[model samples]
Target: MNLKNTMLKITTVVAVVISFIACEDDFATVGSSVIGEPGFNASLYDDAMISAHSYDLPAVQTNNLPLNLLGVYRDEVFGTQEASILSNLLLTSENPSFGTEPVVDSVVLAIPYFSREVLEDDEVVYALDSIYGSSPFKLSVYESNYFLNTFDPETNFEQAQRYYSNLEPQIMSNINPDVLYETESFEPSAEERTEYIVDGSGVTDTVTMAPALRLKLNNNFFQNKILDKAGTASLLNQSNFKNYFRGLYLKADEVSNGGTMMLLNLLHSDAGITIYYKTKVVDATDLDDDDDFEELIEVRRSYTLKFGGVRVNTFEQEVPQFEGENLFLKGGEGSMAVIELFSGPDANNDGISDELEFLRDNDWLINEANLEFFVNRDYTTGTNLNEAERLYLYDLNNNSILADYILENVGQPNSTSSAANRLHLQPLTRDENGNGVKYRIRVTNHIDELLNRDSTNVKLGLVVTQNVNLISTYRVLPSANPEVQRVPGGALLTPEGTVLYGPNAEDEDKRLKLKIYYTEPKN
Candidate 1:
């Protein structure tokens, strides 16, 4: 008889028949898990747990049971899973105070201090919503070149048979003498995969995490922009990927402490290196809109890094690095010199400062020929191209002046293309990652606390005249007792635990979940 999960109601599960030959001495100690049968309090996460069981049905009609038996068995298995799932599941609900008035920038304080709780909810929702699944492409992420390749129909179907053999009666018999089963594996054809590809589910917010990603992005911070992960440094230096910025939808109704992270793509062409900022759409309507879903990129901003050729393109070469704790712009070619931006009140400043200050303050902006006989630091009296008296402008010897690379042409290329693939819950495929990348702004309780402070301030700009090191400096004052926690209805997985899941195929954009609620200007 067919048994639906709803029909099972509160009926206890029937025990399966035994098949294993057992001896009294063979009654191996039934590994006691100390579960359900005892008084121990057990905390089970129904959705996150994976379970599997095997047992023989002593009441089988015959070894050669009718095909219908297979269908019945599958249904029974499904219902059992459903019951277990429903035990701890929470249904979705709307808050009573959800006014269309639009929360905007006006936020409220969260009681009991929790940001991780909020982040957990966001992750759980994302997993349930089908976020971050398998890649559309079958390749690993390519920092340079990457592509997705699947089999042709003939080849795909040819390989599919290998799965069917596992479904045969003989195979099922091996599993259990009374075994009668059905197979449930239907993959899309190549044409179907390419044509009817619907992927890119937004990240869910029904999960919980610990060590709460205080910097994790939220639902509406920076309009869900993804940052370019890497930028090429001039002169063969390994590009720094994580140092860039990433904007995210922040979750913060009330201020506390939390944050988000994002990836970036830094490209290096022979002429120069270009940085692009990218984002994805997470509109509430998109959820209800079940149209041809594809992860699309929303372009943000781009910057070109200006660094002298790796080997001192000019008379002098300077490479930037950190020493004795503080970072300094070192490694110049022709001359060994030091450049300092701020001197008097520059305790927190770097070595390279503004170009304007050198000319006006230190009188070092003149051309090299004029520095009294153009003597190199090596004491080499050289015949400079300038006059016997005039100085060479843009000198590299000044320890206080920073040289600026004036951008002549900032070309905004029209290299637009749609991201066609779904990131379902399988191994994360590399197709979702594109050469084009960006830095998105992300927010959480951390910023709210920042906005609350009187001396709270931050700046976004290049460190020197030359566009290098996109600095996002937050002039933060340390707190003795930092109050950072998860959001309400959210849990901090122990030891930085995560309750995240993705479909074998789902939304391609890997989600960095935010917890605070937000709405667009028009609602």
Candidate 2:
């Protein structure tokens, strides 16, 4: 028989079997004349059939978002990932006031680092979180003469702008015509620095601050761009300033062996450019003295320009293994894994779709459901190759989020208490022997809806947890509180991947699993 006809026949047989079983149970109900009395306590429903399969997800758009760049780096398992950033500089003030006789001291660019702290015993130890392969590559900064057009004149619809992952740098002739600033290979530091804080009584106490990247820019470059035209009309407003000074393009030069990559948070409060100078001031202390009558003294002055405006992170991925197999779960937007639950092949082909249908035919109360993914330890256990700390699971077909993710308030406030966080799965953990490190994603509500409600069963997508909220923002409506705009959002641009065991892998013990815990009614 055809597949549809066979399914109908199996469903008919399941209905008949259920009716017969009900009849038998009804016959056994002898002493239930008094209504509202419980029939029997409960019985365990042990046997539950679960189906799982995985496929290679198509490449997704990885650009025109808030994702920061991960500079040049090459991994043995994940191949190469090189990233660059193009952004506009924002003015700190409308009309910058640099006094006459100002002397340029220095120009500096600062980008903050991302770090986390762990409790060693009683004290907390800080470490870099999203950084990998910390060797170091030559870093360069160039003035980007290529202007990012804010609006498209043709459509005039605010221009739903987007830049792709595979796009190359369209360098302009005004790119300084020379490298503005170049630095030798440098590694990011996790060490802390001491900062002295003075109280109202002038008593000082030292505290540690996080590490950051502060590059000293060329003084001559900024002297001409910023200081020379202090009183000009172009320097009177931010719009005129941006139009005159274009932007910057930060490029990390190529490196042969294992080059390093660092993830920077340009939007951090500490990340920006500062121009230091000294303006002429009269020595008023000795003005009354004939020895120092109105002597010119250098008084320090500084103006800051923050990193903002049309910041776009471009990503390029070269994962050849992704073309040949489906064994790993890559986190970047360019590549990710497709997950299918209850929608794989048939029982004859080693899939569990048919098995799930069989269980659905039988009326069983699903107590809890979970999906666990085991990492391919053979490929992910090197000194440099570490596993991602958190992973996010979402519905792939919807291009939105799973309803359970919202109902459970996965990333919202106060959703992290013991009872509240039950919906959010625990972090990556391993067995006692430390052999199989796995991640478990809770899908009890998803399974319950699939089995009980009229919800659509679509494939799911998995990625690093940070990618979920990378481009998410609140949109205000007429009556409701701000709603989230989630679709077409960006994913992780940082180059990171984890090899997870698929359902069809060779090892049965380490294969992906969909486990369901249930209970059956007793009479």
lDDT of each: 0.16, 0.59
Top TM-score: which candidate number?
2
* Deviation (Å) of 21 in candidate 1: 93
In candidate 2, what residue range of length 10 has the lowest lDDT sum? Answer: 26-35
Candidate 2 TM-score, C-alpha based: 0.75
Candidate 1: where are CA atoms >4 Å away?
A: 1-195, 198-365, 368-523
TM-score of every candidate: 0.14, 0.75
| Residue range 265-383, candidate 1, lDDT tens digits | 11112112222223344344545456535534332332233212111000101122212211111110111111111122222354322221221232111100000011111111121
Model 2 global lDDT (CA atoms, 0 to 1): 0.59
Candidate 2 lDDT by residue in tens digits, 189-208: 77775544434222446666
Specify the highest-lDDT model's number.
2
Q: Which residue segments of model 2 deviate by more than 4 Å? A: 1-67, 116-126, 151-154, 171-174, 191-209, 281-296, 322-325, 344-363, 407-423, 431-436, 467-493
